[model samples]
Target: MNINKLIRIFFLLIISSIEIGQSLVPVERHGHSAVLVDKKLYFFGGESVFGKLKNSIHLDQILYIDLSKPFNTANPPFEEVINAPMPFGSSYATAFLSPQKKNIIYLFGGIMWDVNANVDKFKSILYSYNVETNEWIPPATTGIAPEKRREINGVINNETGKFYAFSGLDTNAQNVVTTFNDMNILDINSLTWSKGSITNAPLPRVDYTATLLSNGIIVFIGGRETNNLVSVDINQLPLYDTKVDRWSTMTARGVTLENRNSHSAILTSDEKIIVFGGNKDDIATPVLNPLAVLNTKVVPYEWSVPTPAPPLPLTTNLHSATLVENYMFINFGQVHPKNDSLLQKPFFYILDVRNFTWVEKFEPEQLSQSPNGTTTVNTSSTNSPGLGVTTPDNGKQIGIIIGAVGISVGVIAVAGLLGYKYYKKQKYTRAIPTAGSPTI
Candidate 1:
């Protein structure tokens, strides 16, 4: 082919090779905590890339996005709230919105760097932020706080104004000290910390999700022990009764899920626990089936895989999943922990749990309303729901395609001009005769 044609083809190929990365551009973070308050979504500390450093560093600032506003997925409008009274950078922390005080959010334990000692330490302190004022309240405590730990799991009993913390990984300067199966209860009303019963508690585990059901029972699923080994069976899950301060186990029936850690789980208004994305054998190997549903309304809790599951090869771990109405928002995590190229891609996904479909954008107003005033959803096909992949706004894609074509045209024009000049020079050289030959 001609040089100009080859140039156009080469540029087009280059454009085609570029992967369409995530439309959302929140800072790449995992092991962070996210909570939905009113129409606002706020996220706290997590492990993130810092400058030229190859290793991930903990973040201290809090960032948020308003769900009421329309935003382009390619460039989400996220506002960062820095300069707050953040004591330290942290990761694998737990955060929940206070039920009594709707405007206040409580942040719990996580791993933070001890700047003075130049070592990693588990945070046992509690920090509260007032959303209305955008200020942190000074932590005042009357009771003993829990031991410093990270990768802990906790959930709030909204009715009682209590935060129940489960077992967590305890670490010191060098390595993991131990994983505790004990429980800690924090009273939001009194700002006090007290211990819970350890009798019949599940094995010392870390990186699990504790989801509180409507009946006031906390369900613990999929976590690993201190040696990074997962022994919890899906058939028999652990349970904690906050009402009685007791622990027990429940045998589930239905599809089984392999043991996993560092996953995210959220309870729906209808009493369904949606568990998604976790690490399997190791951080490098992610769980094959990233999504599962547990129906708590049934006598024996039933477990089932979502119909038309999320797009295949959806590897995620150490991610944060927050539920807002009928939609679940999964934030950044290690998509492919070892693969740098895949890890660089932004990890943000929205799932319409109403129909178990993946959606590209978030539109809260699109919820259908029934005649009486309740929100209506599609529930006809429970087992065979088709994948509803919401097509993102094509404005950005169209612009990129047009820009690519324009660049290709410019390349072709330059290549054609250069080729023409070279051809003319070659013709002139060929037309010249040798010293011993007749001129052409």
Candidate 2:
């Protein structure tokens, strides 16, 4: 090919290569927790779609997103947990890694869907799944525990070996729901529950964040305070002093966030909490500065909203987020990109927390359904389809896509080089001197 033609082909190849390498996969979901264990991200149960639709279902599969995978690949990065005890898929449940036990994840109460009753049910069961042993065990506890609740969050105080739970929604036998503005603690060692002594508590709230700071202080952030379900001021930075057993609102300086609930936040290595992707005015709005950072290491706690913040992969709420290494992996939230409608697709995105830039978006593979209209993973048993009845190999399709993209780019690169070489040789031959020509 001529030099001009070669140049044109080279530019096209470069563009295609870049585009392929920059795509992201976001898992469509909400009300799920993305737990980080070393390099792997473990995503537990969550609500896939919300509304009165009888077909709307809760996601029960325990999915693990391998963050180690190259970000350029546009494929389902999620894998269902295999040979593990799966919970009866739930949403709004709190999950935390056991500080004392290696690879143990403790899951607390959440809301589950009961098809028979046609209502969301609150659960009080606490189960522990050991990632190392691939076993699930129910720990027996003593003392008075909180009633079946949902929309709460907690943190484990490694020093005391205790798990502290904050306010959540309480429902009665008649299905009457009320938000409880109380605190509860579970002893990790004894698996015992007890009431916590907290004064001046915030109003009954749900879907808030409980971040354990470096100093062992659990900072409670935005939620739907009161049964009215309105967003409270971001300035009300409530701090739970586990040591003093007292709750006090801290003075926050700098840019305050818009009131929101069902959002997700992560405690950074610098002792700052980065909050993102929540509802404003009860619905997810497409807006800049959906992200905020709280500098908990400093006195009077300063809140800084990053100027020119990166846009979220989507405007969403009721999502779960956790920090792993330098990147924050946020998966599945309720997307409300339009005013007339909302969707509960399991999509997720990753953010480079260092610069607050979005790294990529990922989408999980479309789950296959069994004949009974239940989702099945890896051809598991036909019994009530819980989070993955069977361990299905989900990464094969993604690997093929990645390999194809890589090969396409490679072939294009080689062709361009060859074209250039051929053009250079043709030009040299045309300029060569004949046998009798002067070698000037």
Candidate 3:
């Protein structure tokens, strides 16, 4: 080979290495998890098809957005936090900030692909990520972890320092194994896992919202059961008393909502549980009532639609919603499009829960100096006298669960085979159709 040709080849290799090292922005996806800490949003595993790619793959990078900075929706400022010991790629996982440790976030079960086995499996292990240290911590626990599952919901009791994980679906090799209606408790202080014996638990379900109230009661909202049935009646809300280790139900006295699953719910300072977008049926149709509220402050509880609904950009489901003071930041998910040309993209929107309206940008409340000369967040304007779930005394919001639900065994087997075929070919001409859940 000529000397000039060899030099050109060396330069090309260097360019390829540089491109490989560059971090790319996260793509639009569903069935992921997110948690907020110190005004920053950290995102984890979800499935998305890469640019011009035929099939979807589990995202492996950890992406986050700094809320303090200004950026456009078309191009948000998302930075990737790369770690060598990071967890494997998975979907339908749930995550929450530690109640005992403000800087740490905990991730629970989800569906992970087993490369060696060439099949999908549940992630049974628990993992923690430290935001301050920018590293993933090896989970050390004394007791047996919860059974392998996905689409499970959990909430942390700020007073007890215990995380209560609820119902989820378990599958193996595209076959439905079990749909659990059990509870597993993890003591955040000791990191010990134990079974929760609660009376009158509801049926096996997935993709629900578990909101921990200030009074130690966890409210379970809409989700889909094993038989593809959804809890649509706003009149009935499942209530679990973490203090008593018992379960009960409450009936609200106002407007009812449509059947929905994979929705996001946030508790306002006024004791209102605001529910956002979700799928309405087994076919994965977007719910008609995109936003509604359940006022826990009122006796018997009451449901009502906001007098004037906010103009939403799209109908979304399987998205992550993180509450920061009075603003609810809605993250990426599948959008049920009326126009077929509308493509899914990595984007977010802010809903001002104070008045139930959408805002173009988020302006965090300013910090003020106290009489002792210590800086404090000025939340007086956003604060109201009511009993509901908010950032606990430890400064960590209760875990918000958002994910997809598998419909049945036949559907799962078909979807799994289709997915495997796509994986082998590495390309496809059209998007895979999903029924209430992503293709396995």
Model 2 scores what on Cα lDDT?
0.67
Q: Mark the 10 consecutive residues where model 2 has the least summed lDDT.
A: 378-387
Any runs in candidate 3 off by more than 4 Å, and if so which? 1-25, 50-56, 83-85, 114-123, 229-234, 307-310, 337-343, 371-374, 378-440
Off by over 4 Å in 2: 1-27, 50-56, 82-85, 113-123, 132-134, 284-288, 308-312, 337-345, 361-440
Worst 10 residues of 1 by lDDT: 380-389
- Cα deviation at 415, candidate 3, in Å, is 65
Candidates 1 and 2 compared: the better one by TM-score is 1
Give Cα-based local distance difference scores for all models. 0.71, 0.67, 0.69
Residue pairs in collision within model 3: none
Clashing residue pairs found in predicted model 1: 23-73
Candidate 1 per-residue C-alpha lDDT over 105-172 given as tens digits, one digit per residue, 9 for 90 to 100: 88788876543443564344677889878776547877767777778777877668888888787666
Ranking by TM-score: 3, 1, 2
Q: Report the C-alpha lDDT of model 2 over 1-440, residue by residue, as the tens digit.
A: 66667667866766776543322333355676656564467887676554322333566657776644454323545676755525455677888776677478888877655544545653456878888776766677799877777888878776677888887886666978876767889998888898876578878788778887756678888887767878777778888888878888987888866788778887766677888867776454633567788887778888887753555466567777766555566666776664324363455567777787776543333556678765444210000001122223356657977987787778687877878787789899979998998897
Model 3, residue 70: what's the lDDT? 48
Ten-residue region with minimum lDDT total, candidate 3: 378-387
